[model samples]
Target: MSKRKEKTSHGFLNNMNFMFREQWNFEKTAFLFALVFILFDLTVSFIVIWLPKVVLDSINQSISPAAFITTIGTITIGLMFLKYWSHYSEQGVLKSAVNILNMHFYIKKDWKILDMDYSLSSSAQGKIKIERGHNATSRNIYVNMASFYPNSAYLLKAIIGFISFSAIILVLNPIIILILIISYLASAYVSFLVQRMEHSFKDVRAEIDSKLYYLLEEINHHAFAKDIRAYNMKSWINDTTHLFMDEKYRLENHIQTKHFMQGLFDVFLFMIRNGGGYVFLIWQMLTSDMTIGDFIFYFGAITGFSEWLKQIVMRFKNLTNANFSVDDYRYLMDTKDASKRTKGATLPAYDQPAELVLENVCFSYEESDRVFINQLNLKVYAGEKLAIVGANGAGKTTLIKLICGLLHPVSGRILLNGTDSKEFNRDDYYSLIAAVFQNVSLLPMSIAENITFCKESEFDTERLLDVIQKAELSENINELKDGYHTNLLPSITGNGVNLSGGEIQKLMLARALYKDAPLLILDEPTAALDPIAEDLMYRRYDKLTKNKTSLFISHRLSSTRFCDRIIFLEDGQICETGSHDELMALGGKYKEVFDIQSHYYKENSGVKLR
Candidate 1:
């Protein structure tokens, strides 16, 4: 258990280091943008503080109104130009940073969840919350962090302005400067108190994310609420979703109330600062140390700094809250469990007729003590077509995964041509094998692209046409507007039409036929097809896989007749094995299941047998 945790921690650290290194580029760009904005802010602060004093002096000394207006207007125009430059510079850098970060995300996302170490993948599942949980976690992590820079820049400027004001006041009198410092510290304490409340209020965000994930999954997995209405489950889901939203608002409202009270404290602080400044000014006046213009300048400067100081405190508090999102995003991107099998041995040549030998293999889920596959031993030789037949809950799929190097057996080992499967590079091994499962996955692409899977640029188009012909899908393709060039999903690309269930099966068969791998594994491929299509598909499968190594897993007993050998699996163990004729002669589990299915097919096909 300690070893498992140590490995998980190492994986998380690796992912975190990767995320932060990518994030650094974004941080640099934001820094440049924020630098420019901060400069503009400093300029504005100086202009606003001094301009009022200049205008008031001109008025008392009988200076021309026209001159005063011209000076103010010129300054305002200059400030406007600076503001535009700041805004443009900030936006441009942020957009660039987001693009670079998004590119990294796109490249890394193709790594499958199943490929990671079990402990790491389990940890990643919680952080990234994929599927119905973490799938909706925003892809805008970079943009969100980049956006924080502009606000931080404004906050920095406010701090600088306050410091400048403090310096000027100190020159006026030390006592007055001391009072203002005290008031500022008091205001900061209030901000910290309010930030704690905000932290508590923000706890509902994860719950909101979870609720959104389930709602999305239900709508999509249930076919956009149509199935929900069919089953009359709309009210239950609706109420549950609403409850989540209400809880989110409840938290948000709590934060707002705390902020409002904080605002009240700010107002009171403002009154104290202003009232205290006036008393000091009166003392300065009595001592005959400063001019009326000097009094006006210091008073205005104090007011300006106080307002800006409140803004600074407020932004600092907001930054604290923003860190929650930053941490959440960092956790998702940096979780080490996302990367595994950094290196492995290269797979050997398939020339030796790659035999799969599982010698007492075993496996279990993350927390499970009971093994899913226990001391399981099996073998399938090259050039021999084998069938793995089992009920739904039997470990048929699990066994196939073990062979494909997708899952590592917890105990014992899987071998290919007498070499341990784990010793070979998993990616290279996968390239040598072709697998189609009950869950058919077709990319949204052209019919030809889907068939070729973008792997071979120079495929035998003639062979593809031959496979389509054998699969009996020629008429369907000819009826299509674009034929082979037609898009598989017209809804996305407007090039192809939707395929019927039978047509999809034929297209899938064409894809598998085109690969012509040394070992072809088909998992319940004909389950959705009609008897005629299924029969035709099996014939095509026989022609395509003739003399090549193949493993066909099917519930239909008629399909197993094409195999050179059959292995009947039950409860993760091979209960029976033989040729179709030999199996029937045994008159065991195989005979009972096969005879029943064969009789049903015979009745449906209107065929009679002695």
Candidate 2:
């Protein structure tokens, strides 16, 4: 148990060092200013403690009234100036430093999430860590380095004050000093118990908070507004929210009860310490040659001693809580990303079309035993348009992710040109391909910036317009008041336009086109469009993908006829592969699905099936 405690102490110190070093690295001047302010503040506090004793003693010494008045006035003015100076430092300098430190951690957390491996970031455990880390930084001010530093400084002050007061009281009566220490120690133990109880609830509280936050966010989210009203889910949502709230309330009430008990214990200790010290001092004054000023000074010292002991206990509790937060944050930041590459061979130049080969690649999700992609062997020739067709769970999208290096294969090699895909730097390898997934995400930026994924200065305006036109989004852009410069996602910005689903898909296509990567992968890219728009997109596919290798994934089998080759997937393996006519001639599963889909169109319209 001692060894465990020692290890925990060691870890806490290391975490504190890490936080201090990072804060210093973020803003050196702010760090130094904070330290200097702490020292100055501590000096002022010590002076305040000693001033009363000095003034009372001088009064007993029969000092001249005018001289005493002058002395008091000078001290008052000096203290007033120090007070305002301290306040200014707190409001102006310290506040800005705290904000900067918070911003640094916020940015660092976001960077870690963005830079994490896709596999880890997408997992349940990783998401929990992310949420916990966010709570660690945001839930309490004491968790912040700026606040923690000041707490440490105040703790030091408390220790110094306690020792100074003990010395003064001990000079008169050693027994009184001993009684105060024992009582205060008892009070501190109660505070420790309360703190431990609160800490134990941290995880449960975080979970409840997370649920409440999600429910609130979803209720207010524009995306969920329609379904919520249409399904009449207001009462359901309210009830769910209240349930979590009740749980949180119960937990808090329990914690507050413990605090209340601790407060009662503190009051009991306070009476014992103060009452005994007063009785002892009274006895000393009556029996010994203690002056009136000495009595007043010793009484004040005893009261100050009690306050110092309380401060020490409270500060220790706060720092311990802060240490726990630091541990949570460090856990997230220290997580190893399996996909990260420190150094690797650069990707081949993108001047020519890229060839991709998957040699018996296999993969499974971390939480599942069953493989999602099993022995998936395939090759795409340079400049070939390959189509992957499958039902919802047939590993079509997983295969695309594996090829894109978003996911790593469990057992086989994925080669780019002739080199293993893992051999190339991940970011450099990513630059070779542009993909459009079913889920469309648009940043709160001007339409042109979204397309080019660059700033206004870096944008190729002509190329942006060309891709927009090619994606058939020219009409939508022209209709908007700001044309291509209009901001998207009104939820994020005051003046932003929300596009229709079809329009957003077109925008995504334009983005992919603007990238002009050697390889393009479109997964259900035209899912949101009407049949006519989908047909129009397919007709222009060859023109858009000129001189580039492209992979098209769609459940609409008829739309893939334009591809050089079509591979039908079933149960994590390829079931059929050929051109449309060749697959139809073979009468495989592809032909069967194509015939069924064509039958629906044939029945709906008088025209013959294509």
TM-score of each: 0.79, 0.90
lDDT of 2 by residue, 230-341 (tens): 9999999989999999999999999999999989888888888888888888998999998776777787787788888889988887777777667667777888866647
**Which residues of candidate 2, in runs, are more than 4 Å off?**
1-10, 31-36, 47-49, 54-62, 90-93, 143-146, 183-205, 246-261, 603-610
Which ranges in model 1 have alpha carbons more than 4 Å from their true place? 1-31, 65-70, 101-143, 151-159, 172-211, 220-230, 235-296, 307-330, 333-343, 350-353, 367-370, 455-471, 581-587, 595-610
The prediction achieving the highest lDDT against the true structure is 2
Compose the digit string of candidate 1's lDDT tens values, residues 334-362.
44532124465655565434677889888
Q: What is the C-alpha lDDT of each candidate?
A: 0.68, 0.80
Q: Name the weakest run of 10 consecutive residues (lDDT summed) in model 2.
A: 1-10
TM-score of 1: 0.79
- Which residue pairs come into collision in candidate 2? none
lDDT of 2: 0.80
